[model samples]
Target: MKQLLTLSIVLTCLIVVAWSVSPGSTNAAPEWQSYAPPHWILGPIQGADGSEKIVLNNLDQITRAKIPITAFHFDAPDWQSCTGNLQFRYSDAVLDQMRARNIRGLFWVVPLIGLNCPEYQVALANNYFVKDAQNNVIVTDNFTGHGSWIDYDNPAAVAYWRSLLDSLRARVGNVLGGFYTDSVRPDKRNGVVAYGEAYALDLLDYTRTYVPDGDVVFKRYGVNTPSDAWLNQYAHVAYVNDLPTNFSGMKTGIERVFATTPLMPLPYNEFSGFAKAAPDSETYIRRMHWGAFQPVMENVPFGKQPWDPSFTPQVMQVYRYYAMLHRELEPYLHSYDQAAFEDQTPIFRDMDASRYSARLGNEFFVQYVTDYTPAVQIKLPPGVWINYWNEAEVFKGNRTIMYRAPLGKEPILIARGAIIPMRVYSNLTGHGTGKSEYALTVNVYPIDHSTFRYHDTTNGWLTFDVKGPTRRVALCTLGNVPSEPIIYRIASIAKKPDTVTEQNGAVGINTAWGTPLPERNNKKAVGRNASGWYYETNANRLWVKISTLGTDCPAP
Candidate 1:
């Protein structure tokens, strides 16, 4: 009898799990915000010398991508060979330019402070450097001999570093973003893992002390960098100096952040053999696959290489455009305060795109991980929700559908009659609409016993709308031509009882904290006195996110 009861329990559990599957509401949680950047990292990567600079500005300078970014970061500088030295540090005029162009200034601080420069000597003599077990100050040869590290824990070091950061803050103020640390702190005893985590956390505490509250990011990853899986210590925005696969061990690092807080993953193109320091473009472009999934994207084009296929222009442009789109879709998302859950992989490290696009609050907050090929499903909330990326319409009056992302594409859709600033890129709907348009085939399903209907604005046509039969509905490119295939997803908002009752793990869409939006829309559009999301993604998942939706930063 006990054995039979156990079997019955197992079957019941499966049914509950199946019923619990939200085949309607996407994201389902209130905190999963889109991890896309609105700006692009502009850099003048070099070749051997002048005349050979890989000019990147050659592309469409006037045409803006999804989000507009005016910031630029330099990755390489040959001090020894160059006969001239024109400091490009932040200036008052530069800061003004940033405000005018809506750009921020991010100074990449390399770990080249202690090699042989008098700066290192002066700092060390003043007891500003990290010391060894024998009380001797630590010093080592940075690939760049001029590079050296001071004891981050030392007061003198803190003062000096803050002084530098202050200079930037003074100039850029609201626009000055902290791109802290070039590489992980070097260590041997506890090793890089421990050192990286501890060192990064210390830096955060140190920065928050001076700037009190400002945006900070970590760039130029090292072999000693800590796993992002638990980067509550280091800043959420990562200014990577290495390849994306290197982060494979931390597949869900970004998700982990959004599950709790908002974060960005900005990767620098560190591929260039032109310079002895940077790697080649192929390796850099190859990182695009992983980089695209991140909220932010960037590349290091050093040695002054012109933007070309050899420099991975296609990859860079696609990433830049995609990132912008991701950022633009932010306002409609129900993230930061949303309760997000993940099916944690049981293995050591596994590949999982889980789900990207989820429909909630009449909008599609979607995601596209490594595998854009599998047939996926999404749930929708009552009423209408639209895909803003591509002009695809979906409604949840009835059931759900398994939708597919067009090949190598991500579209942002809006509700049929929703007021939006911009229009989707493509509006094609239905079969034989166009062969090159769709990539992944999506099958929509219903739940409310109603019907699921969607329209394509690409050609301004009503693609399909089902009335009764619970049959499979499919949408894809209509051609036989061989094209690279991938997957994109759609989801719906989970339903709740109509009665106003205590609802856990739920966040309202377009919700604001502190004082709500004003009538005339005449408000400081910033997170002011609030910590909505301070400069970068924090290390919290959805549940904790909703509870602390806004910023807690002390007002200046």
Candidate 2:
């Protein structure tokens, strides 16, 4: 006889697990505001060095290599006519190409207007530039040349800056994703107006208005900086200040991420560091591993191409591996980002300050190796941790242990009751394509009971609950009906189940585990209606497929 269970029993003991989903009318914010940043943000290559040809070439290289990147960042020189003019230099052809590929164009902007540009004279005539006590325009020589800072303190100056942004957006059209605001330092001042926290905050807020739907405004702040408190609300994404391109720089970048992620949202640093000479192959791969787990995986290489002959082939291999890994875990990362938005909870939680370790929500814990040595000492939190790379290997928590993390690998431990939801790998995010259906794989490591609240662009919200006391495990689905079939891979099962049943009836146990059916003649192939159970003796894992077509489950 089928066992009957009460819904309240499952609801009471289950740990809540939430994963990424499509934005719905859950709050007062815009629907797009609920969306997280893309998994990979590419470019600003060589800093302030950008051209139409350069941007196209990099995109071509990345696309050919099958590396998925949703956004491309153009440095200050790309849009500036004479530095800070806020002009559009790229032709319509460039914008069309980006739009066709569903790629977002992120252009760099600043508060200063170059003295050589006509816009500067207009601002000066209108008293829009910050002025000294002597009533003279405060001209400061920066990287771009002599420029006057726009008086964000003055309403007229703010309106003029907004007009410039409006003009640029009108020219670029839909491909203009957002702006990258740099050089908003707290130290800039004149005798009358000071560009401090309020100025910086207002500038960012104004810049965010220009960003189109499903885009972001990348700001540079929050590493021992003065405006750390306001960054969370102002910027969509916050980046660490530039660091040297070396092992020490990687360590500092990690420390900075530890410091900023607690207060800010989507904190990241440029992969391979930003200063000094280009990173060696070792530093590049190691840093890339760390970047894969960050809230945002950004790649801004300095010197040669990532696939250039200067670096070893392993560098590109590791880069591609981690890039795909980041995209695969998008659903997982997006869930935490959404949580940080709804509640003020930190996305990445620090486990130990002395050790470079942190937790990504409640699912996984990561320990980074800062130096050249592959041996790492990890202090685990209280629980049972399963090695993500090797599911069979498990360890008890609250004790420190030495683990080997060679190149191309890092220490990632999954909690015992983690319910990870993932999607198939793709070279693109299918942003403008309007894709609706997606195949989902839900990995469950059941202990007592756990629930996963999964979300996506197509399927609004679906809940998966797993409960077990001993060897018997029961899985249930609630909320919206899934568009496609779901494959549940239950891990750590010591033996094959005697019977697998759903609401319909008994589920057939396939004796041909890991073997393709006659129709599909591939090793890891199954039919669309492949709803059954398969047990792999070697791994002690059970695979079950539940078909959603013409089936009804309880709604949440």
In terms of TM-score, which candidate is strongest? Answer: 2
- Candidate 1 local lDDT, 1-556, one digit each (tens): 0111111112112111111222222222211112112222222111121221211231223123323443434334331222111123323454454466555444444433534444556666687665668987655544423444545455556567556445545545665444445554444522645445545554544444444333345643355664543332223345444333322322333344233222222222332212334334433333343333333434343333324445556555654554443333232121211112122111111212354333322323334333424433654334555554433355453345666644334433344433211111222221111221223222222222221122221221112221211122111221121122211121231321111111121212223213221211111111121111111112111110112211121111
TM-score for candidate 1, residues paired by index: 0.47
Per-prediction TM-score = 0.47, 0.79
lDDT per residue for candidate 2 within 264-362, as digits (tens), equals 457777766775488888888888877877777777655555787889998988887777667667777766665565544566775454687889778
List per-prediction Cα lDDT, in the order shown: 0.33, 0.62
Model 1 CA deviation exceeding 4 Å by range: 1-67, 70-96, 110-112, 134-136, 143-146, 168-174, 187-202, 209-213, 219-230, 233-236, 239-241, 244-293, 297-321, 333-556
